[model samples]
Each structure stands twice: as structure tokens, then as C-alpha cells.
Target chain A: MIPLGYYIGLSAILFTIGVVGVLTLRNAIVIFMSVELMLNSVNLSLIAFSAYSGNPAGQILVFFVIAVAAAESAVGLAIIIALFRNKLTVNIDEVNILKW
Target chain B: MNLEQIAFLILAVAAIASAILMITRRNPVTSALFLVFNFFIIAVLYLFLRAQFIAIIQITVYAGAIMVLFLFVIMLLNLGDDKLLKWKLNSAKTISVLLGIALLVEVSYFVLHFTSTEGMSPNAESIGTVESIGKVLYLNYLFPFEVTSVLLLAAIVGAIFLAKKKFE
Candidate 1:
């Protein structure tokens, strides 16, 4: 059996990459993708703990998380499409009309 | 170093590499494709962890449904290669990279130092199967399951409302 620490370490690395992507990337869709990456990393950790602790609650929580992520991405992409129709660009820096 | 360990290493490397490529690529479509690949690798990792139901759901929902939606939006926008050549090593990028490194070091330190006192349950193998997940999900988590369905419905309506063309 693989050590649980290895799984946790992998999850952390992936989460950090997702954070970096969100911080550095300017495209709205890519940022959204990075958010999904973060969510997946969290899911991986949950499953790792589930496997290690032999609990079903963590897996069930992962199910809920996947459902929530799917819904979030649907609405988020729709909003992105709406934004694109108005701005004709997906760059985050250029979509600062509401900023002071 | 057994087969499982080797498999875990391979999948972990593939997932991290694909995620990095996904974030770094300039073309949104290319990035989306790499994200799909990353999702697949993650699904396989779930399988290795013996969470078969989640593995299947990860493949179907993430790689299949979510990626398709992303691709559709990418093509709909018809984004060109204009943004591809604009890569810059700005202050935000530098700071974020440093912060990300810090986050990785901190997390790995915790992961390596911490040890679990409780042993895995003897029934760990049986808990992750599809039937067991279904039983627990329907019995104990039925309310959340119903709420998820409602949430999905709301998302569908919201997507339609947001994306519809306005007729004035």
C-alpha cells in the first residue's frame, strides 16, 4: 500500500500549482480551470483520507463536492459567455469596468 | 516500491505535469485539452485509491461533461492566437511563483511530519465499492443528494438565462 503522506504531498503540490495558475493567469476561462484544479486537489485529499481512515463520509463528501463543482462550472461558464458577448475578450485585466 | 507505488508515482507525475502545462499554455483550447488530460490522470488516481465510484464520476463528470462545456465555450468565443505571444514575467507572476513555492514547502513539511495513529479499518476494501457507496449515499445522505439535484436544476436554468440572447 502506498503511504498516505505521498498522496497528501501530491495533493499539496497540485493545489499550489492551481493557486499559482489562478494568481498569474489573466484569462478568465483559464482561471476558472485553475479553480477546478484546486477543487480536484481537495477531492484527492478527501479521498486519500477516506482510504486511510476507512470512512465512507469523505467519499460521500467528495460526491457532494463534485456535484457542486459541476453546477458552479456551468453557471460560471455561462457568465463567461455573457461577459464575452459584452466585452469580446476573455482577459481578466481588461474586464475591469466595475473597478474604481 | 511495489506496483501500486509505481503506479501512484506515474499518475501523480502525469497529473502535476499536465496541470502545469494546462496553466502555462497560451491557447485556451490547448489549455483546456491539457486540463482534460489532467482530469483523466486524476480519475485513474482515484481508481488506484480504490474509490471506484468517484473514479467513474470523475471521468464522466469532469473529463466528459465539464470539459465538453469548456471546449464549447472556447470554440464559441473563437479565440485566436493573439494572446499566445504575450507571455510576460511580470511582478504578479514572480510573486505568485514565490508564494506557491512557499505553500508547497509548508504543506509537504506537514505531510511528512504528521503521522496517523489510527489504523485503517478492516473493512476498508469493501467500503469503496459502488454498492456500499450507493447504500450510504441513499440512506444517510439522501437529503444532500436531493439538494444536489435541485442545485443542478437551478444551474441549468441559470445557464440558459445567462446565455440567452436578449431581444430588444
Candidate 2:
């Protein structure tokens, strides 16, 4: 049977993949994309929960999440670009000038 | 499993596989492209859940707009050959893996315990339709909606500030 559990399981797995990406990937932009993936995965779970629980509030939360994700991507990419210009590199390991 | 279940399973597998490729692939652009495919598969999954509005928004916002932004920046910076794999798992990796295991256990527990009340409900039809969602979204949730817009504005300002080379 097609169950909500299946959707929830898939969502959880996808979110885990995104988390793995964020923790492992070195490129700044790549990490940002992983963050986006994590956000999308969370949205999937939220909407699924909303559909199953008869709550419209979850869908509204999804709307807010999408808007915020867009904004985050913009600012994050800009920061990455600025860092790239400063170091001529996009690798996070090398851009640790602020590190003691 | 039924046909719908099979289909969803296939899509889920595809999306996860591509996500794996996204993080592991050496080329950054390829990784971004894989992410775009992952988004498409996710949008299809959303359709299966009967959230037509969300599926459309997923395509438009994630597949259409955000991906293009990533591609534009990647191309603008000419980071085509920026592929260098970092060896050894950092502490963050260990923590993330543990977190994933915990999430899996929790979700599986809920799945095994809770019985689904069947597919989409009759009321769901009217509640989340484009018309109704818009009505409630703008009326009852008007304050939070406006606040979200302000957040977007701030993000845009932040982006411009970060992208600029100098303050003067």
C-alpha cells in the first residue's frame, strides 16, 4: 500500500544525504547546494505531514521555507564569490585566514 | 507494494542516487547539475502526495530559478576545473553520519507504529487548492506572509553587500 510512512522514510533518507553532502563537500558553492537540498527535503516532510494530519499550517510553513531558501542562496553565493575573489580559491580549507 | 508505491520507490531511489553523485562527483558544475535532477525527481514525488501547488512551486523555484542562479555563478567565476577531493573524514562527518542513523531509527520507529489513514482526504481537496490556499494565506496568515517578504528584502540587501568588493 502507498503509505505516508513511505514518503516520510524517503524524505528522511534524502535529508540524510544532504547532511552528508554538507559535512563532506569542500567547495563553498557545493556546500550551499547541499544546504538547499536539506531544505527541500525538510519541505517534503512538512508537506507530507500536513497532508496526512489535515493541517494547512505545514504547507504555509513550506511557503516560508522556500522564500527563505531563495534568500539564503543569494547571500551565500555572494559570500562565496567574495571569498573566491579574495583568495582566488573556492576551497573552504584554504580560506581559513580568520582561523587562529 | 502497489503500482504507486513502486513508482514512488523508483523516483526516491533515483533522487537519492543523483544526490550521492552530486556530492561525490569531482566537477562542481556536474554536482550542481545532479542537484537539479534531484530537484526534478523530488517535484514528481510531491505530485504523488497530491500537492499540485507545491509540485509546481518546486519546479519553478528550485529547478527553474535557483539552479539557474547556481549555474550563472559557477560559469561567471569559471570554476570549471575546481575539483579537489579532501581526504579523511572530519569530525563534522562523524556527527552527520550519527545524526543520519538517529533520524533513520526514529522515522522507522514511527513508520512501524503508526497506521496511515489512507490517501488524500475529501477535505484536503478544498483546503489546499490554489484558490483556497491563496485566500487563507493572504487573509489569516497575512502578518507572517508580509514578514517573510521583509526577510527576502533583507537577504537581497545582504547579497548585494557581500558581492560588492568595497564599501566605499
Candidate 3:
């Protein structure tokens, strides 16, 4: 029998790596990918805890999360494309038209 | 310490490495490819956990549909090497590192203290199978599940509005 800690620890490590990617990467596309990674890590943790607790609720939640994540990526990439077209760059620093 | 564990370790390492490469690669196409590879590895991990339905959904929704959408946008944007926006190491890196360390420390403490060391009863029956999951979802969480579909519709409309060309 595998321990829940093992799964949770793995999820934590993956989540940290994703958080780092979101922080350090400047490319908008890469940041989008990092967000997906973070969502996947959450799915892992949810599934692990669901297995631990013997409840299907968490798994259902994971399903909802997956749906939302897919939709989010679609919208995020679309917005990125629009921004890149108008500004000719996806770099966060140079395209700051909203800076107050 | 068995084959399953060994396979999972390899898949996890591959996934993490591909994810790192995805962030660092200069070519957007290459980065997207690496992201796809990473998703496949994650699907393998889900399979190892005996969540076959989720594994397939991971591949279909994330790797298949979402990535294709990303690639479509990348191509549509026709983004090339823009010298104006180069990625550089910044002061934010320090803050992120510190934050990551703090999160790791907190998770470790929780893992060590809050949770018992008890192993879950290996669910020999179908815990994550599609049929069982669908039954439970439709029966108990039916309303929320339907609401989630509505949320997807809202997101689609929102995305279309955000991407529409503006006329002056």
C-alpha cells in the first residue's frame, strides 16, 4: 500500500516547480503552461487525498477543476494572441500599457 | 520499491524535466512540444495511480484539445524573436525563491505532523473507473457538474469577446 504522504510530497514538489516557472519565466506562453502545471499539481493532491479519505467527492472536484483549467487555457491563450498582435510582443515588461 | 514505483519515478522525472525545458526553450514551437511531452508523462502518472478515466481525460482535454488551441494561437499570432522583450534575471527571482522555500517548508511540516502515517486501503475495486465515477457524479453531484458545464460556456463566450478585433 502506498502512503498518502508519498503522493502529497510529489504533488508539492511539482507545484513548487510550477510556481517557480510562473514567477521566473517572462514569456506569456510559458507562463500559461506554468499555470497548467500548477493546476495539474492540484489535481494530483486532490486525487491523493480523495483516495485517502475514501470519498468520491474529491475526484468529482478534480473533474470540475480539469474542465475549468481547459477553459482557462483556451481563453488565456486567446487573449495572449490578441495582445501579441496589437503590441507585436508577448514580453510582460515592454507591453505594460496599464501601468498606473 | 517495486516496478510500479520505479515507473512512476521515471515518469515524474521526465515530466519535470520537460516542464523546465518548456519554460526555458526559446522557440515557442519547441516549448509547446515539450509541454505536450510533459502532459503525456503526467498522464502516465495518472495511469499508475489506477485512475484510467482521468488519465485518458488528461490526454484528451489537456494534451489533445488545449494544446492544439495553444498551437493554433501561436501560429495565428505569428510571433517571432522580439529583441524588445528578452527574459532576464530580476529581483523578483529572489522573492519567488523565498516564497517557494516557505511553501515547501509548510507542506513538509503538514506532511510530518498533521497527517497520520496510515496507508490507504488499496482500492482493489473500481474507485476511479469511468462508469463508477459517472454514476456517482450524476447521482450526487449532478447539479454542480451541470453548473461546471455552464461555466465552460461562459468561458468560451468570454474568450471570444476578448479575442475579437476592435474597430475604431
Q: Against the true structure, whose lDDT is highest? A: 1
Which pairs clash (backbone N, Cα, C closer than 3 Å) in model 3? none
TM-score of chain A of each: 0.98, 0.95, 0.95
Q: What's each prediction's clash count?
A: 0, 0, 0
Candidate number that wins on TM-score, 1 or 2 = 1
lDDT of 3 by residue, B1-168 (tens): 887677767877787788778776777777789988988887876666667788899899999998898888777877666554355667887788788788888887887765567755467237779998999899999999889889889898988887886623
Model 1 ranges with Cα > 4 A deviation? B117-120, B165-168
Report the Cα interface RMSD of each model, rounded to 1 decimal.
2.0, 2.2, 2.2
Q: Can you give the TM-score per candidate against the true fold?
A: 0.95, 0.90, 0.90
Q: Mind giving the per-residue lDDT tens digits that candidate 3 earns over A37-99?
A: 889888987877776676777778889888989888868987897787687778876667689
What C-alpha lDDT, on a 0 to 100 scale, does residue B105 get in candidate 2?
A: 81
Error of 3 at B84 (Å): 4.1
User: True contacts preserved, each candidate?
Assistant: 0.74, 0.57, 0.53
Residue-level lDDT tens digits of model 1 in A1-100:
6778788888999999999999898888989999999999999999989988889999999999999999999999999999988877888888897999
* Tens-digit lDDT track of model 1 for B1-168: 889789889889999999999988889899999999999998888877789999999999999999899999989998766554355898878998999999899888898897765544567678889999999999999999999999999999999999896523
Write one digit per residue (lDDT tens) for candidate 2, span A1-100: 4677777777777787887777777788888898898898889888887777777777888888988888888888898888877788888889786899
i-RMSD of model 1 (Å, 1 decimal): 2.0
**Chain B TM-score (each prediction, in order):** 0.90, 0.83, 0.85
At residue B145, candidate 2 shows an lDDT of 92
Cα-based lDDT at residue B161, candidate 2: 87
